[model samples]
Target: MSDVNATSVRAIATKDFRDAVRSWTFWGLSLLFFLLVGLAAFAIGYFGNADTSTADFLGTVSQVTRLVVPLIALLLGWKSIAGERESGSIKVLLSLPHSRIDVVLGKYLGRATVLSLSLLIGFVIGAVVVAVMLSPPAIADYAGFIAMTILYGIAYLGIAIALSSITKSTTIAGAAMFGVFVLFYVVWNLLNFALQILMNQGYFSGVEVTQTMNGNEMQYERLPDWGLFVQTIDPGVAYANALSVIDAVEAPGFGTAFSAELFPSGVPFYLQNWFSFLILLVWIVVPTAIAIARFDRVDL
Candidate 1:
């Protein structure tokens, strides 16, 4: 295949975005997203008694970013190529002098951009509203949260786009992709839990435990922080990772523990943050690459 032009990608992206922003499907759902996030920020700000801490904000923000943001991306992406195929537009679009890979990647990127921009705007507004109402988090921390959330959303978009390539029905594509995303969120936890039980029961008997004196008291805990090591394998761990990133310095007053013990063990607090980001990245890239490869072999 010939090189994909920057101009073509941008043109396709712009077209996709315009169509997306104008459609009732996009606006209707996006409006709901804004309202939900707005209400969440409101609840946390007003009724939450400004009892917010960095961890509280981070946790809430992560929930919004990781879950809600991904759902929106899926909504945009699930229908992308599938809807085009169903409407008989894919042939015409594919006939245009562009590689299928470019078309697919450009569309996905465009929709991901829309999701990222919408979420970013909501985050800014929410941050301002919270700041005005209560003591806000540090600017740097909130910024970091936004960056991580955006990356997390991009990963979900990959999943949706890949799923879209699998079917020609928008509804089926949406449902299937949503189901998979839900599975990603839930499965890792089940694995983590099972592994935790087995580990604590000495399934990995080679795993060592050590006794340490924190302050003259002898405490026995598993070495290599096997329990925490288990958590690293879970998606919820990424949510906690994002939370820890935001709450490292100034946590909120929500009675949520910011202690290192509350975090997964075996890694320094900062390393855990990096590790979680990497996990989230893997979560996005692996399936996405598979989808792209699958699409290459299928006749679209």
Candidate 2:
């Protein structure tokens, strides 16, 4: 592999972004997001309390985006590298001064940027609809939510791009994307249920705790700290739970309802809501880094 030149990476990223923006895929996704957010805003305005805060509105939107953003990002990246390889364009791309690292990194950045732009624009339009139906929402809080949602999409893009880089067939890349969706959305939830069952059956340890809720002493059994960590491993869970970390959303117990009341002593560092950000950052970095290294040594 050649040395990674920032200029080459930027040029490739620019080309990829232009290519994608011109395609139906980009505009189609934009329309989908526009409708999605517009609908969510309409629901809040039409059904929610007269004084619902921006945090409340965004908290609800986060639930939908948690799933939708990953799907869109995965689809965006599923063909990015594999389609190029299959069509023999990768050879032409690499024939330039760009390194394998440049291609992978550039592709990821370009796709991520496309997704970010689509999200920002969609949310802006959605926000207008929100203002019309309800009172104006908090701008800072909404911007922070948008930032988190963009990061969430980028994290999934890293995964899809990494998988695409390892294959020459778009079919395999697509299967990998579906597998990721299953792994996080299905298997992860089942795993949580399994953990709960094991804990209930005394096969796995459960943490016994007491807290005051509604002015009454309450007792509950929670999965152990490690088990709790397992739940946060899902990017969707991390994204929703991590919303509490930002100042824009001031709602209490926002971290998947895992609040200070849940822990009688103190929340473990790994269980802290802010840890979701670290997990997300890892998802973005680890996949791309490994893919770049492997792609560098692979035969194109």
Candidate 2: clashing pairs of residues: none
By lDDT, who's the top model here?
2
How many clashes show up in model 1?
A: 3
Candidate 1 regions with alpha-carbon error over 4 angstroms: 25-30, 48-55, 135-137, 200-203, 210-230, 233-236, 246-271
What lDDT would each prediction earn against the true structure?
0.66, 0.87
**Candidate 1 lDDT tens digits, 7-58:** 7778788888888788775556556555665666666677675457654555
Best candidate per TM-score, number? 2
Ten-residue segment with the worst summed lDDT in candidate 2? 247-256
Error of 1 at 252 (Å): 10
User: How big is the positional error of residue 214 in model 2, measured in Å on the Cα after superposition?
Assistant: 4.5
